[model samples]
Target: MALNSFPPGYTRIPTVSPGPEDYPDDTDALSRSSSPSSSSRRPAWTRSFHLAAAASLFTVCSLAIFSALSATRISLYSQSGHALPLPTHQYFGLETAAVPPCKLWGPGLSEARQNVEAVFYIDFESANDPPLHPDLEDVAVWLEGPARFAADVSYAQKGRYVVRYTALDAGDYRLRVDAFRRTQTGKPYAYWLPLGLDTYNVTVMRQDGSRLRGDGRQELALPKERCRGDEVGSRGRWVRCEDTPLPCTRYGWIWVPRDCIFHIYTPDELAKQDLWIALVGTSVWRGIFFAGVDHLFGPLAANLSAPTSKFWKCWGRLSAESAKMRISYLDFRQQCIADTGALHCSGGDYLANTEKMLGKMAQERGGRGPDLVLWESNDNSHSNYTMLSLYRQWFGPSWTGAFVSAFRTYSPEVPYTHQEAGNIAAYASRNPEAKVETLDISRLGGGLFDTMEFPLKQSATFHWHNKCDYEGMHSCSPVDDMIFQIAVNRAVERQRRLPPRAPTPPATEDVAEDIRFCLQCPPSLDFSMRPEEDVQCFAGLPL
Candidate 1:
């Protein structure tokens, strides 16, 4: 596939159409001359005739000038209706300078190996044209393939530029190069200025120079150390968790933030906890729940219902004699309506529904709330078109900002009122005993800005292309698993710090009695999942 062939819903930068000013101005030439003959030598009637002719000529010239100006104004007004394009090179005072095509020289594309850094050199050398000097900082280099890689660029001796990037997975990848230059006013280009998008197709192979082969049965393990909340939002790249000499598919990679150690608790450690965990959020949280279950227990039964449902609540329980754990997911969007048997929300109040569910959970536990509540709401808040005004302000004239603005204009979801962050803070303050942690999964998937980082904050380019669903709302695999690990680790650490709670009696009813059970399910909760197979689990007898 062409690297420039962006997915549906993305608007490519358009070339600016030539305006009226771009065309040559039409001039109406007028010749003026004075006769040397004196009026005394001519007849009085002749002078009168000459004077009348002069006045007529002046009037004709004035009418012609008015017509020309009116035509130019109409032409410019018509062109203004078309879409505006990026500024031309002449606007940047580089009209005479030639932009030479950037050339790449380094190891062959097939020689790239996984986990090994691939080095390449770029130079703007041409036989016919003189060399061009562009600020290395203005150039942007990134890769699109099975993994996320940021090609590092630095100036070498002379006019050569060295580019370095490491491949994490053995697969085909594309190295995309683009450059941006500021105008005389020092403002960056408002759109993607393509300096050289000479896409290089690279086939990354394992160290053994063999194709990666594996059934999906590889057992994934958690890292020993857990990533902190700050690290979760920090700048980082995706890297294979286990980088053995020989490439293996046993473990998937994780996004490790800068200056942080990211590892999850082992299954043994997770099995030792006896706690009730409640996950309240959008569909993304549903994926995290399944990923956590897969890591803690074995794969779910294949015949279970789909990951999503019309019902508001579902439960996953590990009823072991020694260690008991019950995880309940409350769908903030869905509400069970009595007697209708249809999936619908009443008053469209997500926060109110979430609070109602929490109260119900507490009532079921004999007035004791869940030990830990991992909460998030409206992961699709940025996708709402009504918020385009706010997005334009939040993300200014960068390339990502332009793309986001166009996306909101062209493709937008039904407007959803996002829950206020302060409301979450208030809830956490009210429930001092319970560990109420808010997870910003959107930031992990690059839906929000990273204020601490510059380019990320301004460009919003830290998106995990390979790890996100098509709409870029929910995160797939290792990312979802990472989210689960972080939530569990925080809960475990909080339990160790606080006093042990009095054990509550087992519920008189089974929470999963009406719901189906499944061992096999994709570990992401994006909208593109199995939509046709959704099954509803009605609300059974009240708690």
Candidate 2:
């Protein structure tokens, strides 16, 4: 079977229209000659009996005609036993010639969902367009569903027809259509064909946008040679004519220029890059900062920024650098792992969401992992910050061994703030072989800035309060974001220069000094949060 075509079970039912000679002639209904003259000569009793007998015979014939007409209307049913009403064919007289032959095709998607649309065009053998047949019949298309739902369509363009009806509930749907040509006596003669016969399941998801939930629904999946993007609607490079000297149209392909394309790196290409980072957090990362965050970089730029209702600041420098250096920076800030041990993440679980975001890349690029992943967690936050371990595990053994803590942000709340920072930093410290980095913005006075706005605004300079100076949770300022970006870029670049698969330990002391002056910890410290919790306080004492 073709990847996207309907299965072989799809078949067309043939309907036949009877000719004028098919019905028996009504010889008994013929008028009698000289009826008035004969009645006058006959006896009154004889005339009365003749009238009574004629009346009885006429009533019987009328009843038989009604039964025959009623039998023509047929009811179609879905495979699931949902019944749909077929249109009543009104025939006027006998047909002289046969009904023009045409095939019922489709269940094609329409922008409107309250309807069933199909085509009744005649199939031709040649590549050339065929002329419409003069004797072709008018066709009707209708949709039927569960609960006796029925609708007929009168609107048609040439051989195309659209049957509009009330929005149907979720269930099986069947398409019933007929093409009727007029006999010389004005009688209708045609065929009524059922196209899909419930073999095609019709699942209607039309509230936001219309989508079907059946296996036969159409989705474009272009192979590597056909399109640059792994899936449909993804921005990608198009194969040009010069690339392979192949006709773009012949193999069901179209060539688009590279400049007109959006550069989307496959997962393998991203893994091969000097830097590929994934940001994990909450509303701060998902809705507020992450949406359209990629637009700030690359060739596409709109000065548009996020809503002013939150602590989001533009990442112009970071995005620009990413574009220039071709870095892959991903954000996974959606809510995950509620405080009560529930995994309410998008698409069900952590791994599911991960696959949703990167599975296509895995399929296209042959299973590769990102180079660096920067995750965020706040102890005071509602989420269970320890769930990061599950996320770490989801990445699996190839990427989870390093634990380098280079920066810290501090808050006045002693162990609550310190403990929160320790929970995240210490977790990283335990993984000696994984190439991961942790910087507690809260420990480095990241929470000290004014909660309403960034202290540095759009400044590229790395600046932040050396210690906790603000009262509430130190919301990260614009400077903190920049510092994180700088650290990530630096680490990725350093990793790129490292010997293949060698333990990528910290090589420079620059980051140690960067976080040291911001907050003071004991000269020597165990990577543990609370003495009672039995958790490591730091990755390795940056002091």
Candidate 3:
């Protein structure tokens, strides 16, 4: 992990074992003090004299040794091996040598409708005296949301400072901590400086806590600091903005570069990552768009035998490296387990199925959690009511969920698409954490059914291949397949651009509001002819 080369025989040792004087350049000290012949001729007792008196010469020697002993250090743990190596003076700067690289800790999980524990650990670099506990007022811990809530460092013991915050509602949240010593004049500590900064994401739950997943006690990598200023005075402010302001993704769930909002993730970017994403819900996620005469029938339609295995094309052009996606289907009234290990049957058992998928996700690459989770609900559910509740439980009341409306239906009574524009507004009003706007495939209004002349005459059915030949074959038209591919591809692109879940503290507020506006909000489509239907058709259209 050390980026720079050391002396040919330089063996890496625990930093505490060496004093500042023990640096490899000690020969310069001997040269400056005495001639080489005289130094070599010096008695063994004289050399022993310097070693014994080293403690009285430089304050840094004692400070470094005791600092290493007293400092409570936190470490990162991840299955993906994404945690960045600790920065060192050789690679970063000598000024940073005294500052401990901030460690990010804890994969915080929310027990739905309960509380989320956001804990931060820091090394008290200068707290040498056990009798006096370090004053932490200068250290700040906060949860970012529409309104920032500062956390209290309520406990400190054994050189470690522990700050704990209880999440009030379910939604996504970013947890941040800033630690630094200050001068007597209230500025940052200049000499022998000690500073640590970190931020991480935390998801809280609103409903059955069991729906939440992951072992909350594991440590996650802290995000890399973006603004590593050498100066001491403004260290606090600079470290807080560790994440450079990137243009927020149009849909909100992902973070994209300022110039790539509409374009989303490029193929190259996806190809370079080692990530895992999970999709859990009902038939909508069970390769609904890939169902056709050429594919299998029912919920497992997309899972084909070797002879007809073309359904994987649903992912479109994305071919990222070491990327895995876990997809699951849950039926209405089915018993499902939540992340909290409780069983729930509401809303098509989404919570349970999602939790189950999380379990499967953990088993990948030797037990790691998914970087992102995407769930598709049945059309019959109210966009605002069901989505917001579910979003609150997964993300927290302050974090937002991405809304994606189903495709429009020709039959008015088919329980058609969500009025995305209206539903987005409604969900946002009640749940500000609902940050990601709905990706409405129905935006292709009239385009799918429009008329156009081509040099080669086209068929009346617009290349229609099958008309629901099998029970779960929702749409078999080649055109419909293209449309579905486009819509879902856009969704994947949005997710692909999301900043790697590691290297940054999980902070979920209206990140969308901070960087960009919704490029295209859901349109106010008219659904006047749709029949009054309270239930979702789970078994598919009559054959």
Which candidate wins on TM-score? 1
Return the TM-score for candidate 3, rounded to 2 decimals. Answer: 0.28
Taking all chains together, each candidate's TM-score versus the true structure is 0.39, 0.28, 0.28
**What's the residue-level lDDT of 172 in candidate 2?**
40
Candidate 1's residue-wise lDDT over 137-179, tens digit each? 2444555454444555666755577777666456666666554
Q: Candidate 2, which segments miss by more than 4 Å at Cα?
A: 1-273, 286-302, 306-351, 358-368, 380-386, 396-416, 430-437, 446-448, 454-477, 497-543
- Runs with alpha carbons beyond 4 Å of true place in candidate 1: 1-226, 244-251, 304-322, 334-353, 362-368, 379-476, 496-543
Q: Candidate 3, which ten residues in sequence have the lowest lDDT sum? A: 451-460
lDDT per residue for candidate 3 within 329-440, as digits (tens), equals 2221112224343334453433444444334434433333433444443333434334434432543332222333332321111113325434543555565554433333
In candidate 3, position 501 carries an lDDT of 43
Which candidate do you rate higher for TM-score, 1 or 3?
Answer: 1
Q: Tally clashes: model 2.
A: 23
Q: Which residue pairs in model 1 clash with each other?
A: 223-263, 223-264, 225-263, 300-518, 300-519, 301-518, 301-519
Residue-by-residue lDDT tens digits, candidate 2, 262-320 = 12222222223444343433223322122222212211221212223111221110111
Q: After superposition, how far is residue 43 of candidate 2 from its true place, in Å?
A: 99
Ranking by lDDT: 1, 3, 2
Error of 1 at 63 (Å): 96
Task: Name the candidate, 2 or 3, with the larger lDDT value.
Answer: 3
